[model samples]
Target: KFCNETSDEVDRREHPNKHFICSFADCKATFSKLWKLEAHYSRHTGLKPFACGDCEKSFCTRYQLTRHHLSHSGEKPYLCSVSGCSDAFSTPGSLRNHAAHVHHQKENSYVCNHQGCGKEFRKKKQLKFHICEHTNELPFECDFEGCNDKFASSKALKRHWKMHKGYPCDEEYCNFKGKTWSEYQKHKKTAHRVTLPCDQCKKMFHNAWFLQKHKQSVHSGERRMFKCIREGCEKSYTTNFNLQNHILVFHEGKHDFACPFAGCGKAFAMEESLKRHFVVHKPQKTKLQVNLCDGCSMCFLIHYILEMLL
Candidate 1:
């Protein structure tokens, strides 16, 4: 009675030898062949039939699939394991190529012996190209009679020959002597006098550097040098560099270091610089408001005799 019950259970679970059920829940999808079942499962799961074991990427094509697996296995079966070369590959064909082209260093490998040229190639076709430099053998000649320069390749010759014909030059002071009209136009616009006019005044310089310097010196009214006597503050500098150094050394602080000065909520590179800057916040009697230009003004906490130069 126990054997009959076991047989009935097996019959209920098993398919008719050909039919296969989908693994997904509630969906009673069946296939006659195992391959059909796999294909059907792929549609539901978006699974790739072929996979590369090396990089762990999957592909549909067998060739890509095979290549992908090689990356993971480090199985460059093809290799050029010659002396002086530690290169490894996943395939035999690639290895054989490395040995023949790079490592083997064949006897018949012709090279260009030109003074400045150092090109070595295995094929004679490449060697022929190298020989052209020494012989000055211009197979391609420019059509322009005055511009009789020859080139190794017909394409280069064509480009050079185009230079002989007149082209449009757009530069303010540049002469139109380019091989093509478009090149002349580009040179005129880019290399010539295309510039940004300053919004402030009539004074103009070639670039923005002169303009920035003019703003800093002419517009910045007072040069307030706040020098601190803290142990870290060494040579006084123009900008924040000296101040940052002071904080780092005396205060044991970093560039992003916390301010060790009690009740100060600022982080500084140097402690001395921070202390010197904090002095400005304290109540002081002698304060001077120096006006540089009509548009610029700065406040200083020190006073000196203003000498009228004009």
Candidate 2:
């Protein structure tokens, strides 16, 4: 049982499996065992117990720590026993994955069948995930109420969950559990004694990346800016990516990638969107079931609709 704001026994042992639930306000993740619950809870507490001796890197799981150690050791236990060349890998998956990119060009049939986008893969799973980029289908979604956030990968969704379920500050007096990764990193530096202590304010940072960003954004006077030097525009950006985006979206209004349908100037910011829009232009061979949004009467693919509705 996990203790929380409500001080509840957040576990139930059923016939099939034991369910250990997280007691966080928005987090409703349930695990089969107490240890799994503890591990999951650490994600919200920013507690990375597993540390690498060679570097300042730390991980929540020992498996991740083991994987990190492999980078320093340069040990690839798994090797491809197939044909002409000898190739080694740290994991079994890597050996198989690299074969598609490097050697074993004949056997693997896992190739992208998308028109003009013929990329080869070692496994069907890789190809399937890659297909989502063209499809623009985000499978992972936040389960939090009132949040309709979606992600292409489960890992991305898990990372994004930091906003919904933040790691609590180690400092007893501090009640700051940040709403984002950057916020939490900064909060850990400023509030907790996890990172190197700041000389001026006596704050701590877990990593150097956060410390540098904090200095640049908060402490340092020499701020990096990508300023839009327009006639009347006073808009400035921190990164060049944002500056380019501002120029393209508002300044230039360049519709480089637009819908192929005649008289439709529906512009897209990304090329991936242009690829997905091609599906709309193509005549459907099989009748794809779609649902219409009640609010806007916009049609959506059935699977996508089901994913959203569920």
Candidate 3:
């Protein structure tokens, strides 16, 4: 006899003993438990009884409040295992999805079936998107007045809208621009708020940060180790300046820095390295190894830069 026009026909079930339902206007959501009904009704009243311990934000559901706390703690539970890829995620499914798409290592790739096109993609979502490209369909467009900027995806359109809201630095002779609100705030804080004078170069900077970069890159005793970007190459260097020189001279077939010794046709990446080899054929200097904390190398690097400033 349950033959109502709008009721769920086949998959509907009635709760006999527990009969809790939302009393909110125009909301027909029903729940078997009182707590479930309370949670559903809270959305209509804009009532957020669950408050986060670390932040002022509140949520209607306890689960949402729990999830919001993770952001304040800076916890990324999922991590990528591929070499040279440090991308992290908040969930395991996201980590797996990124690995499959970015690394091209996923099994059973989804292939497109559009006539004579046999290109394969890692995900079903990607295959659907590739099909749309052949159809010449750009569904996402800017909402700005009289603008006709169309994009293939929603994310592209979102980043496009930020073009209208870029914050530019107004300091005399400084022509830096920030693309996002967070970036604008940081630029203002670091570039104009606090004046930090470099101890080595004696150059005045807005924030205390540029001082450490000036010291490490320009005057620090510790040298960085740069590795070859060519796949399967096992070569490394004391500095990127020398490493880039190596790529250009040896790999790219350039002979800019030749050995000055007569009858010695050997070439090198940097002129200084060539001079050192001309003196005596010695092994390259070892890189300065430091024990860094796992999963937070950047945090340590920023701390090191700040220490150098002092």
TM-scores of the candidates are 0.26, 0.33, 0.31
Top of the candidates by TM-score: 2
RMSD of each: 27.7, 19.9, 19.1
Compose the digit string of candidate 3's lDDT tens values, residues 111-216: 9888989999978878877887788788998988888988778867878988875767767787888888678767867777766677666667553334545565
Model with the higher TM-score, candidate 2 or 3: 2
- Residue-wise lDDT of candidate 2 within 65-125, one digit each (tens)? 8887876565888878777768787876677668777874455568898899999987887
Could you tally the backbone clashes for each prediction?
18, 3, 1
* RMSD versus native structure for model 1: 27.7
TM-score of predicted model 3? 0.31
By TM-score, the better pick of 1 and 3 is 3
- Spell out the clash pairs found in candidate 2: 44-167, 189-204, 195-205
Candidates arranged by lDDT, highest first: 2, 3, 1
Where's the lowest-lDDT run of ten residues in candidate 2?
7-16
* Model 1, position 69: C-alpha lDDT score: 64
